[model samples]
Each structure stands twice: as structure tokens, then as C-alpha cells.
Target: MFSTGQLIFALFFILAFTVVLIVTYRKDKTIHKKNYKGFGWVGLGFTVFVIILFLIKHMLNK
Candidate 1:
């Protein structure tokens, strides 16, 4: 079992880490929007490819 001090430290650490992470993401939000534009289509294509592969495997196994 964790000591009380250890649990308190973890709680504060998590809160500080989350705050820092949100601030960092907000600072870079505009840069990310420009850089990662059209990224969703690539993800969609990859997902479709995986689904096609799974379907082919299922059909062949039948």
C-alpha cells in the first residue's frame, strides 16, 4: 500500500502534468492545424485497408 505522502504527491503531480500538457497543446494548436491538414484522410484510408484485409481473411477461412 502507498503511504499518504506518496498518494498526495501523485495527485499533485498528475494535476500539474495535465495543466502543463493542456497549455502546451493550446500553444501549438495553430501550428498543428496547418501541419496535419488532410491527415484524417490518410487515417481513413488505412482503416479501410485493414478492414478489407480482415474481410478477405474471413472469406478465405470459410
Candidate 2:
């Protein structure tokens, strides 16, 4: 059986990965679309929500 610490650690690992992805994506400015700004921000918000939900589930399962 997995331990609580393991679940928490995994959650943190995923969160770190998400942060890295978001930062990398934001820094990428090669695209010239004057209409994607809103979509981009909404996508980032979705990523954060998913991370938070995953963390909550991990904690609750313990």
C-alpha cells in the first residue's frame, strides 16, 4: 500500500511540472496571434485548478 507521504510527494511533483510548463509556454513568443491572449490565460487557470484538485484528492485518500 502507498503511504500518505508518497501521495503528497507525487502531488507536489506534478505541481512543479505544471509550473515549469506554464512558465515555458508563457516565455514562448514566436506566435503572432492578437486574439489568443484570453485563451492562454484561461488555459493557465485550468491547469492550476486541475493541480489543486489532484492535490486535494491525494490528501483525502490518505
Candidate 3:
């Protein structure tokens, strides 16, 4: 289970990423945001997705 602080940090992390992307796109023309997905993060994202779904199902069952 994730604590409130953990959730808040994750929210802030996403928000900071969005802000950074917007700021970089506006300030620079050729930042080159995306080329290809790196293996680690892609795997991590999928793992996180699965974990979230499992957590949801477990909570619902409870």
C-alpha cells in the first residue's frame, strides 16, 4: 500500500514532468523529446500498471 506522501510525491512528479516538457518546448525548438522507449522504464511502467490493477482488484474484493 502507498502512503499519502507517496501518492502526493507521485502526483508532484507527474506535474513537474508536464511543466518541464511545456517549458522546454516553448523555450527550445529542437529539444527532441522522444525518439524511442528505453527498456527499463517501459518495463517499469507496465509493472506499475499491473500492480495498480492488482491493488484495485484486491481493494474491491475486500
Per-candidate Cα lDDT values, in order, are 0.99, 0.87, 0.86
Candidate 2 is scored at a TM of 0.45
Best by lDDT: 1
Model 3 scores a C-alpha lDDT of: 0.86
**TM-score of model 3 relative to the true fold?**
0.44
Q: Who is ahead in lDDT, 1 or 3? A: 1
Better of 1 and 2 by TM-score: 1
Say what the RMSD of model 3 is.
10.0
Shift in Å, residue 9, candidate 2: 0.5
Residue pairs that clash (backbone atoms under 3 angstroms), model 1: none
Model 2 Cα lDDT, one tens digit per residue, 15-42: 9999999888777654635546588788
Model 2: ten consecutive residues of lowest lDDT: 28-37
Q: Clashing pairs in model 3?
A: none
Could you tell me the TM-score of candidate 1?
0.65
Q: Report how far residue 5 has shifted in candidate 1, in Å.
A: 0.4
| Top-TM-score candidate index | 1
